[model samples]
Target: MKRFHVHVVVPKLDESVRFYSSMFGANPTVLKDDYAKWMLEDPRVNFAISARGGEAGVNHLGFQVDSEEELTALREQVVAGSVEIQDQPGAQCCYAASDKYWTQDPAGVPWETYHTLGDIPLFGADSHEKTVAGASSACCAPAVSIPAVVQRKVGCG
Candidate 1:
């Protein structure tokens, strides 16, 4: 099984939490100082919001798979279609460890497909690591472009 995922960056955590909770008719399943997540069964979506001081609006969209096999199948589909992707295996982000593949849609919206492995105490375990291009890694999302070497290593175009 897979759940549709949507992450948004907000300016105010408390206000956004209040608004979303009222709209969803339930409180978030996971709430932190700067983040909140609602695992909504009604819409079968994993909707999350954060106040991380970034640009406000949709942060990213994704599919959260239940198992590694499902993740692999999704990855294979992306590869078969020859889409450019950034693969992050054993990534710890959004308070969870996951294996993820990221790609941009035709309109340039970023999308992620991942399988969660477990929870983590931090928002992102490797938040400080520099990418192959020497740019600081974004906490929950990949940079716009991955280095060719990394793309080759991940077997993604």
Candidate 2:
């Protein structure tokens, strides 16, 4: 199964967390000082919020696949569609490490499709990502021209 993903950049983390928790009727599955995530089965969405700069609105939308086969199929479809893609293997972000594909939709909205590999302690895209060519994404947000996000901490390898 593939879960829909939506990441929003907020002006205030706690405030947004409060609001969304009220709306969703549950606490976040993952919560940090500047980030929170709700892996909700009701809507089957991986909804996340972070106070990591950018304007207060939707950061990016995506799909979180369950297996490597699904991800490979997705990548094949993207490649066949002629959409430009930035591939990140072992990417650290959103308090988790993932294999991600970054691209934009027809309206140019940034979209990420990834398969989470494991969790990380922090919320920043670490220096290890810099090793991947063209992998300049920050923590919890797409590197594409989605919006102006705050610079990530350096050397968090």
Candidate 3:
């Protein structure tokens, strides 16, 4: 099984948590001082929000896979589609260790495909401080410049 993932940066963590909780009709499965996550079974989504002081909007979207095989399958699909991808074999982010690949959509929205390994104490194992938008240094995929030809074919430009 794969769970759709959405991470958002918020200005007010507590208020956003409260609003999301009310809207989802449930409390967060994991709540930290600055972060909250709701693992919803009904929708099969891993929705998270944090007040790290960055922009108050969507940070990234992802698919959370249950196994390495599923992750590999997704990577194959991305490759077949000729999309630019960055592979993080063992990444520690959002308090979980995962093997992930990162890419951007035509509109430049970042997307992640990962298989969670386990949980960790810190948001990320990297040394970089949180960004003004409240996202960790490893929160999103590093930007990759798309080739003009590919961009044109995809109507990106």
Candidate 4:
């Protein structure tokens, strides 16, 4: 089953964890000093929060697939919609190694489509890559400029 993934950039991890825990009515499935995740069965969502650099709101949203095949299909879907996608074959982000495709919504919010390969000990890769938003993205979010034509078709331009 594919899970809906929502990553929120939080100002305070401990405070957000407490609020979400109460809202979900369960403790986080995984909790770290600066990150927390709730793998909720009822909602079938992978909800995560981190004290990462960015606005304190939705960092990105993604679909968490169970296999690479599913991830490929998602990439194709984005392409078919005329949106350009940036591929990350083995990206270590959000404490997981994943094969992912990154793209932006018409409104320019980052969206990820990925299959988790395994877990890692860190939030993201060590060396920072220049991101679309400048500096580095919180969770290996790819930095790509969508073509003007593509953006126009999607009403972003």
**lDDT scores of the candidates, listed in order:** 0.84, 0.81, 0.79, 0.80
Top candidate when judged by TM-score against the true structure:
1
Off by over 4 Å in 4: 129-138, 143-157
- 1 or 3: which has the higher TM-score? 1
**TM-score between model 4 and native:** 0.86
lDDT (10s digit) by residue, model 2, range 1-157: 9999999999999999999999999999999998899999999999999997888899889999998889989989977766677677777887898988777766768888999999989786585454225546566555545332323456966
Question: Sorted on TM-score, highest at the top, how do the candidates line up?
Answer: 1, 4, 3, 2
State, as a TM-score between 0 and 1, how close model 3 is to the true structure. Answer: 0.85
Stretches of candidate 3 off by over 4 Å are 128-136, 141-149, 152-157
What would the per-residue lDDT of candidate 3 be over residues 26-51, giving only the tens digit for each residue? Answer: 99999999889999999899999988
Clashing pairs in 2: none
Clash pairs of candidate 1?
none
Candidate 2: worst-modelled 10 consecutive residues by lDDT: 143-152
* Candidate 4 worst ten-residue window by lDDT: 145-154
Q: Which tens-of-lDDT digit does each residue in 7-80 have in candidate 1?
A: 99999999999999999999999999989999999999999999987899999899999999999999888877
TM-score of each model, in listed order: 0.87, 0.85, 0.85, 0.86
RMSD of each: 5.6, 9.8, 5.0, 3.8
Model 1 lDDT at residue 20: 97
